[model samples]
Target: MPALDLKGCLDDSPKFRKRIAVYEDSIQHFEFSLKTLTKLTRLQVDSSTEYSQRQQELATDFTSFAQSQDDPIIAHALEKFGKSMIEVEKCRTMFVSRMGQAAYNPDVKPVIQNSHVTETFISPLEKFVKETLFPIKELKKRFEKASDEVDSVLSRYMGKKPKDPTILETAKELADARKGFYQVYMEYVSKLNDIEAKKKVDYMENVLAYMYTKSAFHHQSYEILKDLEPYMRDLTGLLNDTRQRHDEETSESSEYQDLCAQSAVDIYNPLNAVSSSTVSSPGITVPYHNTTENPNKSGYLFERKGGRVMQSWIRKYFSIEGEYLVCSMRNTKTSKDDDQSASYNLRVCSIKLSDSYDRRFCFELISPQRIIVLQAENEKDMHEWVNSLRMVNQKALNSDKAPPPLPSLHRRGVSDVTPVIKLNGFSGSSGTVSDSDKELLKMVREKPGNDKCADCQAREPEWASTNLGVIVCIDCSGIHRSLGVHVSKVRSVVLDKWETESIEVMLELGNTIGNSIFEEHVPSDMETFRINPNSSPIERDLWITEKYVKRSFVAHKDDKAQETVNQTFWDAITEGNLAEGLRYLARGANVDYRNPNEHLQTPLHRSVQLGNEVSVEFLLQWSSNVNEIDENGWTNLHYAANSNNVRLVLGLLKRHAKADIKDESGKTSLDLAVEHQNVQAVTALRLFAFDKQHNSSPANSLDFGFREAMSSFKQNYSFERSHGTSHSALDLRQTKSHSPKESSSLHETGSKLLRSDSSQ
Candidate 1:
């Protein structure tokens, strides 16, 4: 079937709805049929087992009847026949075993052994239905909602009279709604097409596998029966020999009886004797079983906690990863709490057995934020968990980079502290940093211009706009938050958990680089037009709105030709001059333009190939598609991994680059990374996959730590901000205006400084 079109979806075409309904019906039918097939296949395997057992029973009965035969010759023949029947029964039993392995054994290894019907075939069908098919229904609902919103906005836009004061605002809203609709429409169609294509190939592949398994079962049965033929032929001779031996054995019966009695005594002696250590006693100390090669421990534990009023215990899966204690909900599907997972820094917590609780086998983990009460399976488990925590905590304390003690909650406001972020847990309170957070803070603060606020040039900015890639003071952060999360996603530099991708953006574009793009055309009278750290809240708010919201100061060259603008963007990025490149983007350069002169590579591809992360970050902020392919159908991720640049690979993945996209060689980014032995890159990709499988929040993805090499790039660009010319907030309010000549001179000099510094 042809894929649904976005235009049809956005227009809400009747034909589109009809086609979608038909597709939905087909999907339902396919699901029903596949589930039925799985159920019947399992039944068939069970039935075959029963048939083999029945045959074995008949063979045993025949052997008993043969032993009661009257004549020796006839008895030998009958006995030989019974023995062959038993051999045939064994062959039948082998058939059942092969059939089960071929049909539905999950334990069968898909790599080293042939793919089984369940793990390789049926499981993918189920996953595709769950992960792909079901999500399409939700996307359709959102698309319809967006489509209706566009209609409503468009109706208002068209109904307005000419020269209405609200016309511009209405037009902007209409445009935004239309843009939202288009995005949802495209996503819906993409998912619909994906599921449609998957069902076709998946069903055929699964059925082909099922047929192959059946063929293998029959082939193996033939081979096994063929091998049994020699055993059947030898049965007649075996029966004759057995009759002759029986006659001789009758004479040695007394000797056999004596040997049996002595053998029984020998077997009983070991059974009767027992080591003193093996005996159970209240005073005895038993050694706990240690199965792991490493110190890390993971298992289920019941934690005591309560809702708003009533207290109860909830089972959770807990594990020690590095120097942190991580816990996740035991039943993810039924979990009602939004906190599905959580991790605590072992360096800031102490673990000990607790008798204060009524529950037995309980321990308490005391931290600055809250105390967690956990119950283990038994006495041994409780001891092991406590000992493990102690060991990890001691290791952290002995390490050179252990985190400092968390601050007391009672001494400060809750807003000043980091809120507890649950990874996949039921209950938690926020405080303390995992060791990774410290390194993250150090790396981000070390960025150019990061020591001060992007706005007003305030010292030691403690907040950041994750989307805009700029740090700001607490005052500017309040203004950023007012702009709404869509425009500027404000996050704490100290008190909040930062996602890996957000940090990548921070590392690439700090205050200096961000200001160069956003404030490229700031008025020359900086004291009059701009605000400082001590500026009034009103002035700060107005300046921020004009700079970020209205984007009035961003340099634009409307007169430049489209081709010239794009060429300048390409050139500026190649030269690592992001400010100039961003200026060209403002002039209407295509961020995703595929230049034929460079093997049809987009700016993103070129940046990754050149190992310039700043350009890549700029393109991403501009909303360039990370999955866009070059002339060879290779994404920027492919280029990064192929070049063995793990940072670029990680950065791309953080920006939501599709890891499964294959190049012309049918190799994914992971495949290329493996080929190059990029261990870190491979680990990053695998972790991304794990996050998806567990439905984890992207904020918790493993951070591929910052690289020292990026500092060299920053040095080459000379991005050090000039903070010497700061005007005091007092001086700014006193000076109403300055000479036009003085303003022009200062602006010209600052521009020259920026250009010259960038050149170096």
Candidate 2:
């Protein structure tokens, strides 16, 4: 299937629209039914040991009586009806569930989402449930009811009771019940026979109808697709071209529909083979075996033989039948039937190399009933048999992981962007930070009291939480990390990585930003939350959580001088009032001013996110806390990283913006870059880290051309933005480069960054 041409389906014909609506309704129904089935499966069946044991006992007694040729007529009927009904019930459940999954395969689900082809896919399933399972289920129930009555009488008369519990009245009642059960059983069996006899014919007819209906589903669209694909090999080509064109140029042209409809007239009629059906004899044979063979199953074959017991060390034939590894004393030939043929269920059986024996052909098979020592004729045969058994075991256990679909498919949301978004800029490149980034960092570092721990007010706080954006002492950082990444995303100021976007967040909400919310409602009588260097682990945790999480001493937002200072600072940053912001800094005002708003963003944080170079430079020059965090535990770098402004990223990296600072979710600025697929940002961050480690800068770094191009790209982007010019993504991708090696190297670096991230 050439991936149902999604773009071609732009045609809003009445036929297509009708189909789309029907498809949606069917999908809803399927989803609801799936959820209901899942819930049903979760029900605690056979919950208690006594209940399960009783069921087992009933089944065993019934089987034994049914198989015994000498059993009473009523007993035989009870056993036969009971076993048949149970098997049918199990079959119905499994078949329905498996069929539902096939009918609702998620891979093909999107096709239905855009079409009205619901009846084509779903009608056969509905028919099967109605004609096959429903009728079988009804008959099975009647058979079970009759069997239960027979069982009741048998239990009363001669079951596991210690004494003769059968009185004259009870015996008489049992006889009447037995006769009544026989009558019901016969009627139920007669109906069941009728159903079984006609089931295949009815089922095949329904299936044939479904196939014929679906074979022509979207036939018109397929014809259009066929015309579109003479040169195009895979759907990927057409899809990519269509998507790229759609994105590159905003066109609402009806050319696709017009072309499709116009092309239909010139198409010559191709010879069509007349539809016909043929029936062949499906021979049925009785599945009779000498108690050991699995008649219906033939699985992965290993022809060689291995002995069952060490005493019988002569090699014997073994074959897999479903989940069983059946061993026979003789070759698996029709003429020679082994009397001691044994079958071990691979589901519960474990095979391993024999510890006591040195022979290469010897291995041990441990089952629930016995430990069998098997000896193969040769080492190669032994290895193959062992491998075959283990392979069967794996099929039963489902432990292989090479091509799992869950993890790969689940990564489609926030982290779904291309890993290297180097080409597109915020009108800025992904990386190659700017003067704006540098200024934002400087401003945050200069913010008053922002450098110290929010709780302790300890000088030179070395650690911070990206989400809370509050700097903390090392002791408190440890306590914060212990709270789990959710409660406190702690990172080292100097040592950690930082994304440009998170750095911006830190600038937005630093000390002044955090304190107002945490301390707004503080009572004078309450003890301060600050901790000393000597504070114990418990003391640090209590104070940290209480300060950041609990807000134990928080006060109501008071209308005071502090509020005016905060509001003025935020207003200056928001409005790009560099002069006014300077005055506040001159008057000993808080540099990292937090807004009283719910976001609690600081000046530099908001400015970087806004890509305001002037405000960032002014704040940075004023010596604000660059390493400070905002309420969301993000720094200025984080904000810069998320933006298209490569200049903002450059500014922070030049100022040594911590690239490793985790946000509220424990994701670093680099992680955010990767998540957003800011390829340029990722490259710049990694390059900066590499340069920093090697004591190199953009001008001096030996990895020359690409880094220079990135720097140049950032400058050009800033210039364009300043001049009120916007470059399209395609134009950005067309930027002049010195060599293919530059991009290849960047790609390699990005691949390494991803691998490093996984290791972290």
Candidate 3:
């Protein structure tokens, strides 16, 4: 559109107004279009960047697959394909980068002296809208105001008599208003003209720049792909040949039909399936099985007596090659790299089924040098492995060429490995330790500071303090046991059967975390205070006592007033904020801080009363005596039982809360639980009583049956909570700051309800 005439603006005619309105509308449309373009451009750049990243990830996957391939030709072809894909990904990544730069700043320029200004650089379209269009809107507003003032002044001047004193004043006001109107009108018209020209030229120029950047990106990508054309064609030809060879092998396999006729569960052969491309047949896929005639067999198996003293079983990759039984040694933190692969001569070894052994799927390879015992995953796997070994051994014996002589076994010290997630119970709990324990043991020992003793830095810590979540040497464990269960509950990682929750506790806080907490403030100058691997029993005892019992090295905050610290502690407990509570505890907030306003209940008591087990555990970690009594003589256990929360009751007992301790009412927690008819809570308390009778550690209370019962109960309880099922006693209530009288009244009402339920 042509610019609105300055002369027309001076006339202030209806025609001029109409023309200006059209220009203003066009400017609004232009602004909207530019915003849309900018938004779409940003989205396109983001999408392209994501696409490039995904392609790069796919290329990496291709490279990994190539490394795992057995066929040399296929592997080579895949490697070439992977490299080409990576190159294409790089091109796409470059394109994304260029596109982003083009959208953000089409014209590259040297950054200014100030880094902050460089970071805030606005794109061309955005800059034009902000710096050019916004000011034009402001000018238009000023022009309208000036025009209104001139019209008002002129009307008054025209209304006055020619000779009147007011006539001269009105005329002078009219002239001043008209002059201001003229200046604003000219500026507004000038801005309108400038923007109109910019809208036509600048926008087209930006579009041109976008097209150029896009064209350059496509050309670069094309050139990159063009370079790989010959290699891609060759790879395709090689893949075609591989497919033809595979077809030939499938057709010539005499055992394929026999394998298919066998039970589907016993054997899987995908070659027996009807092809999807068959015109008249239904596409039926069968289970896949390798049909190669090779007698070689390799897979993961449990190797007995592999580690030191032959006490632990270790998983090893076993493969039969010719007459040698090759075992791949894994690199664990506890294992050395001296023997990466161990080979046993099958020609001199006698294979026998271990049907008489305690463990299922056991077999023994009796070699002239040493007996190599192995366990398979199942009976079928075991038989298959035995058959493969026998076949290889017989073939070796019949060969005209003499086999290699028997070699000595290279024994490495293997730590007892266990699974982190417990699949079965042990010792104080029910059931024998399963083979799943190996991985968990390895995982725990591999944790930082766990490979060595937490106290003496002894290699391969076999014992762990369950409550403290630290692994220690056998010698250190004896000291930990002496410190009392409340200080550190010790358990044998290998010997003791683990509960899921206990293992989770250990995994959550390994030796690294334990040392970080206990030895947080250990002085560098006091080297004598720290015990080494060579430290004597007396030195270790003194160090352990100072570390766990005395907590001499624990960081403390003495700066905060006792009142402020106690108040913060109460607030954290009330809000169920474990992190904040732990922080304040380190800052000298008493874990046993009594809330005077809430019947002088300690943090632990209050947490149980509020049904906050998480906060209760947090308090226990900070050494909050679970046996501490409230003003009403109610302990945390008493509160937990009265609440009828079975989980909470179990947790308290596990933490060594005195279950037998009587309250002011002359009733123990178990008595209260039974009176309230809290069946789960009562059961938990009774089982705990039995556990205390049989076991020294209160934490190891649940047997297999009881553990299963509790597990089921927990699942059901969780389901109820998740689905918003309401329970009168177990419902978690929101706690608020209340006056002493109100708090007392609330507790009284709760007590009355419990009494009412018991009486009924």
- The lDDT values for all models are 0.64, 0.53, 0.65
TM-score of each: 0.34, 0.25, 0.33
lDDT of 1 by residue, 1-760 (tens): 8878767866767888788788778777877877787677667655765665566566566656756655433444444445444444433443334333232222342122222455545676677667776787798799889988988999999999998999999999999998898898778777777778877787788777667555544543444344334323433344556678898888577665665554433222323333224433322222232332235778888888875458888888888888778887756575578346788898889988998777788999998899999997666667778888998888888999746543332334332443322221111211234456567667889887899889998888877876567899866776776676656776667545454445666776678877887888887764486989766445777899988888778777457777778888888887877656756765567988888788888888998899876677767766788999998889988988776565676667757789999988898887776665543345445545755676454333221121111212222112211222212222323444233443333333334433333344
What is the TM-score (0 to 1) of candidate 2? Answer: 0.25
Query: What tens digits encode model 3's per-residue C-alpha lDDT throughout 1-760?
Result: 8778899877989988999889899989988887887677667666776676677667677767866765544454555556656555544544445332232221443121211111122177778888987888888889889988988888888888767887777778888899889989888888888899988888677666566545544554554455445444434544566689898988756455554455343223322333223313222223112122236777788877645545667788887766788887665553664336688888889998987666788999999888888987766567778888888888888998988654444442212222122123212212224445556666777877789998998887777887677899755766776677777776667544555545654655687777776788887765666888756445777899988887777776556788898899789777975445544554566778888888888888888888866566656655788889987788889998887776677677666789888988899987787576554465556656665678564233223344444444544444544565433334323333132443234333444454454666
Clashes of 3: 10
Worst 10 residues of 2 by lDDT: 272-281
Off by over 4 Å in 3: 84-122, 162-169, 254-760
Candidates arranged by TM-score, highest first: 1, 3, 2
Q: How many backbone clashes are present in model 2? A: 94
Tens-digit lDDT string for candidate 2 (44-84) = 22132223334445655666665543423334344534443
Q: What 10-residue stretch in candidate 3 is worst by lDDT? A: 112-121
lDDT comparison, 1 vs 3, better candidate: 3
Best by lDDT: 3
Clashing pairs in 3: 417-437, 417-438, 418-437, 418-438, 418-439, 418-440, 418-441, 419-437, 419-440, 420-440
